[model samples]
Target: MKTVEVQNLIEIGLDGAEVEVSDPQGTGDHFAATVVWSGFEDMSLIQQHQAVYKTLGDYLTREIHALQLKTSAK
Candidate 1:
């Protein structure tokens, strides 16, 4: 999930942002994603995170187990 999410972030984030998604559990059951993006240019920090969260959708609601998000813009 981390790898896939990272790839998704990179795809959407373009060269504008640096992204990191981690799962300390090593079981892929629980996860945390930290994203830094310049694509946030005109958007507020919260909005930027909202964009990322929109991507994950039902995955977290159902099959993802547990997930947390930290997002920023630079």
Candidate 2:
């Protein structure tokens, strides 16, 4: 639930992704992240978001309450 933990999970899941995460309200459950990876190339916006969500997996459903996500292809 910590910001670094979230960042680590995303980085691991997305392989060489560059991930930046922050807790905007200083609350552990709420997060904002920007993920950049070459694998996102050719994917639609929705698909890009889905990939990030999939990386978070069950944490998105349980530990994390909100995620303001932004993604881009490197």
Worst 10 residues of 2 by lDDT: 52-61
- lDDT value, candidate 2, whole model: 0.95
How well is each residue in 5-61 modelled by candidate 2, as lDDT tens digits?
999999999999999999999989999999999999999999999999998999998
* Backbone clashes, candidate 2: 0
TM-scores of the models, in the given order?
0.64, 0.96
Deviating ranges (above 4 Å) for candidate 1: 13-16
Q: Which candidate is the best by lDDT?
A: 2
lDDT of 1 by residue, 1-74 (tens): 55566447454745655667677788676877777776777887678767776666676666568667676667
